[model samples]
Target: MDQLLSTDMDLSSAETDQRIHDLSGQKQSGLAWVKANVKEINDWVDRDGFALLRGLNIVSTNQFSTILETIFGEQLSQYIYRSSPRTALRNNIYTTTEYHADQVILQHNENAYSNCWPMRMGFFCVVPAKTGGDTPLADSREVYKQLPEALRNRFEERGIMYVRNYGDIDLPWQEVFQTQSRDDVEAYCWKNDIQCEWFNDGRLQTRQFRPAVMTHPQTGEKVWFNQAHLFHCSAVDTEMPDSIGADYLPRNAYYGDGGEIAKQDIDVINQVYRDLTFSYPWQRNDILLLDNMLYTHGRQAYTGTRKVLVGMAKAAR
Candidate 1:
């Protein structure tokens, strides 16, 4: 086990390479070192919400899966209600968001818009991008504290409603549910508290109401946790032409009562994320472990190829 490093400690005066924990030396000891130090690692993550484990020399998806299993002590969670494309490398190991390298992914907790979500997640960087592509991490606790009192109160009171219209242009219902059978998808939706409807045109629509804030099961700390900004109409408006109406967008979010979320509020939330996010360039074989309820993660646009593998564990409601 290596010494735990605090991200809050001023690193401006220290050499850049000395800032993060380098656990490469522990490779010789293998999982034994991780097993012995699991408590320390968990405590660090609980305090910081995220930890960067660098230089483990993890080469393949199989190795990544093994390492994650050792840490999580269980099988990884299946990615249900997918928003981005990803290919499963093995049973649970997956390539992180298969979007274009030039696309910027906004910060959000994994599956925050859904009824159930993973309690923790890990990202293994196998290949570093030519430039940019740093995964930004933001403390959800800070996001909650920084949010305006009125907006936070309103969101906590009403919760959030996510609506999706699945079709060819966006992710199809089959792909999103990871099942070709409509009955299976419907069953999943029903079990997950999602309302599903089918259209005559072979389209599928679903609506779900989820909390905007959640108390961490282990720590019992309230954190801002929702994908309102990512699913808002303003997000679609920024990418698509003006001809597309908000209602016709692939996905959108509103208050739990189906009331509109103002664009200004969304902008404020985004700005707060930008102000609070902490980011670092990915180093090959660097692994990031996150307390999903306490932290949010996002991808920055890059110029070249970047391969980051991801896995999640400990599903919680």
Candidate 2:
């Protein structure tokens, strides 16, 4: 694991040479060397929002977890209040996402839709796809700068309200909340400011209003930080059947007051993401670290097996 095979997504290329650090060398020097450069590596990620670490021996999930904990100085935080399907390999490291091979997972700041989110995240590409299975990234600060002033103003004024229904087409209530007790679910929701309603048919509906933009505590920079585009009817309809009414959809986003956002607005937001998002082919054994608030990550559709593991920490409210 001494030499690095450059991938476009590595971000260690000429323009971003500082973003990649070579950790492969003598057998005994790798992890110790990383400890010495912690501040520098973190600085690179802080300045650029993400960085690629080359030549690491991250061959297993536990090894990945150890590296992440060693760098961040904390055990990986549990993926509580989960939104997507993922299998826990061990040590809180998880499969990034379990969506179908051909379905594209939209870019999102980890747990951004919730009141609490992981501030730091790390990803390891244990298995690269045959062709297109890159974990593309976007700088949220750039996203904020590129968005139209009017659109920003509207979102700022209204915030973002996410309405999620659980039962049939998506995750069940127990899985989303990670518990079976209704009382426990209510207690969790009460603590998180999420309004949860239970139906007789064993379904649950939840609504929460979160700010569309967030100020990074460390950077003092504002970022586009909500998942409105991913939850809008237009995007959901792309995968869901047209016959499914918007009301019955698994999730949807609206203005804070619950007013419908104009379709054109969602289109513009999605288009901006299209213009800004990018990825290089993933190479096996590549590790990527991100300042979650400063960046958003997405997955590409691929034909073969693609395995990426995640370790998230630095919880912030």
Candidate 3:
């Protein structure tokens, strides 16, 4: 599963020749076409941390899954959004949705709450909404660069404390998976091999903890792993009697109320993130790949029916 199947999907003879001609003056590698293409792909990833492999006609889910494993390694299952037969129709009906990182963005790496790190993370948009659902990426490195030294030292020293209240809102995901049995939730936990404390007060609620920072296994880059969603949303319960949103704090960590962090710092980080953000309006058949580690993305609500399919892959170490 880790090794790529040498697919016969290479370009035609003329196409390869043309590509070689285009790169004639450039640094030439021994293996003419494929090697050169590989170098180009690597170069793009080196510069931008991600690449958009356009017009990939992935005909089936199995093929898609194989492709992701080939490219990113074996961690695709942890993050992949396995599309259903009705995925196209369902995505169309829910024409718009707000943006946020993965569920565990609220948790630390796979065992930061338990003792693991995610191998890789990615998403493939099968059908993009009509408007306002652009994938924006902000470099964490840049976000860290803009952090005040004192705040950095505080986070580096004390780290962050995160808490989540799933009881507050009936998230779409919760509802989608909610069943009379609560078995689905239990099954998910079991499959992931993580210990959990579950509740069923006419619904299921779960809480988990993780570290404030993570060290990337390959690059040794340390990423801020504070579960902003929990801290931000929890912190707001203090000053505002009635409000809901993600927030954080450098001082008290998990003060405030309802999981909201601090409004001021949240705004500052959001704005700083906005500075590093890049946007591409949704196109009919566009396919985008993301480096979940390097960039954080969000979505905006939109009108008109939109359909999107998503595939998450692991990152190659």
Candidate 4:
């Protein structure tokens, strides 16, 4: 593969350019190249939180899966707790958030609201959108730094509580757990530290308590790790107020003790995310790898067709 080089300075700084590593015009392609440079690529990702590989030959889901396997080893994590609409392509590869073209997906760490989450995640851009559709990234470390002292202290002490009411209006319980049996879903939730209750109408309501800030296992850096802003009722108010009522929204967030998270606080958190976010237009054939604990990612609104496949691995305890 082409020699990877850092394109910018501190990744956490908003003043710096997006970190990208050119992997085009390489001497080797596919598994061979990935196997040889696995350590190097991982080191870059560790230091920068994310790396964008350009000019690779990956075009299909199979090829992307092969590359992911080479980097993350044979076993990869499954999308157990489905939050967004996605179509599974093949072999654990799924289409990136299947939301409407006009919708914006706020920045979040993959599965951050859960007790378990992937340590590493990757995205492959198969087809670039004609307009918009940039996969924006933000440094979680910076997010932590940007938060006000009082807010940070409050979050660390209270943690975060995520509440989901799953049914026809949102994602069905069967689909979220990838099982039709309610017993199986309950079992899965029990093992994952999630509390679940079945409503009289057959809807599933669940709640999970997770840390608002966590120390990265490898780097030991403290990062703002929860999805409170993304899951708060205010998010629905901003995005699709006409379509769903705040109480009927698929998910909402609160303090670990079940206290309401103020909308003003959510607004401040969203602003910090927007301020720290670094976005670049998607280029066809580009592959981006991220340390899920260190960086948060989001999707921008688009006008035309956009095909991006995603895969995750290395589950964090």
Candidate 5:
């Protein structure tokens, strides 16, 4: 941590609204500091699951993008096939999640249900809530080792199948795909090996199979890398409305061979995530970088306003 803060930069949290496009001049200090410790940050995140770099003077979403792009040495990845509602604040930055303060987002690896996902993700806290809003983290490696051998064997063999229903209850197809045209959505599905079914009633469904565990490209370690619990019907079965059919529940997971994953299995996954999770309260201008596969994250229900910007980086297939 001292190596990261070796350079002399403004340690105070100066919240400014002006967007920073150029990293030269006054912005160069932060960029240079990040450049100096780039390897350390990556090394730490690879050794552990994540690294929290506190005390940075980030002004706007553009500045957050600039610092993260510097560390990544490339442009940030767009949040495609998004499952949650997030308003884009800049070209590559968006609000973490627009869910109400009382809604607790379930723990899951970012985009783990999809074939392609960002290897790294950064979260910048612009505003901290008055009460409780913490991004809890869990080590997926431990999750993998602690799960039952029989259950792991089943998932390793069958993989995981994710089915998403779009229209009501869940996100609409247009929002999920970031397009209004059906043709565009179909083309994307075909390219990504996702099976899409369009109903005459204006609803859309997609099914894709992805592995439940993956070996980290950098660490050569296996991690429990799927979102079965978050996507299962058991996650929201109690709050579901009577009018909506159970089959139409927003998203669900099953065995790769088209068999249902029992609710008990989902319960077990959730319990393990809860037991392994750890969190810290947000301080404004704090930046968090996480290895998306090695760690899983979730939001806790809060009281007042909370604002956090997210950038996904280092795309991996």
Candidate 6:
């Protein structure tokens, strides 16, 4: 098998002259070499489904976002506090079951339900999970080609229905997050363009509606997607939820009866993950840039103290 491409080649490009003016790496006076070779640096990312950008200490969110936009385009999602070092460290004390690609199932693409397109995503590992917490990734494009005709037709026509009961899972991380104030939560919702209602009890709630399948804006490849299974909050009753207890929220999915996929289908999908997945055991400095549409990722349970910082950016089309 051909070795997966690595970031060692002399990646110069025609656009390097123009790129110097657009990137901050040149203005700041450090990393001038990277700025001079900007096209090559960016091409490495464009050519690969993902890239492990080693040694660059991405401590500044603004600088990180700039680097991402330079390569991925301008429509990146602004950095938000997905979690803090102090908080993420506390949350990792409790491990959750592994699921591929974001907080949901092993589905392909991001924001499948919405017309809002995502070009790609960046995951910064600030705090790694304890033992056994490796991240597994797979090439969805390969999976798409290898999918059996029968399953392909069924999904092409019907898509997928994802359902989960997040509250029942009793993840401790949820408890730590409950400490957020109404305004803090509302700001978060607003930033993500989530429609939400604020309760008298100081809780903000909302339901997100998005497509279960998505077409890559450029490639036009079809992807199965839905946050219902991953982000458990996808279907929760945002209103009156803080009163009843956070876990009371029910995460569910509805699909055509009889024709809907079942556990058997999930098994097959997971099998694909197992076959195509590449894993990176967390190192404190590891930074992962993922082709959100082309690859899927997951996390596993672990035991030890892992500290990873994450910065998420959407790729540009």
Q: Give residue 280's error in model 2 in angstroms.
A: 2.8
Q: What is candidate 6's lDDT per residue for 1-317, written digit by digit as tens?
A: 00111111122232432211223323443233345556776565567666665445455445554555555545455322221112322211212222321222233344443334355665555567655555566666776666666765666665434322223333322342354465665565566555556446433335444444456555677654443333333324345346555434433333423243444554565555556665665555445666677676655545655444333345332
Give the Å error, residue 210, model 3. Answer: 2.8
TM-score of each: 0.91, 0.92, 0.59, 0.91, 0.88, 0.57
TM-score, predicted candidate 3 vs. hidden true structure: 0.59
Q: Which ten residues in a row have the lowest lDDT in candidate 6?
A: 1-10
**Model 3 CA deviation exceeding 4 Å by range:** 1-43, 58-63, 78-119, 172-206, 229-231, 234-261, 315-317
Candidate 2 lDDT over residue span 44-156, tens digit each: 88778788887766546777787788888899999978878898778898898898877778778988889999999999988899877788788898889899999998998
Candidate achieving higher TM-score, 4 or 6:
4
List lDDT for all candidates, in order. 0.81, 0.81, 0.41, 0.82, 0.80, 0.46
Residue runs of model 5 more than 4 Å from their true location after superposition: 1-29, 239-242
How many residue pairs clash in all the candidates, one count each? 0, 1, 30, 0, 0, 19
Residues 1-317, candidate 3, lDDT per residue (tens digit)? 01111111223242433221222334432223323365565455555655655444444444444444455544353321111112322211221122221111111122233223334433455566655555555556666677667655555565444333334342322543334345666676465443335445443333334445555554567665444433354323354333433321111234222243455665555555555565555554444454555555544444555554444444322
lDDT of candidate 2 at residue 146, scale 0 to 100:
94
TM-score for candidate 6: 0.57
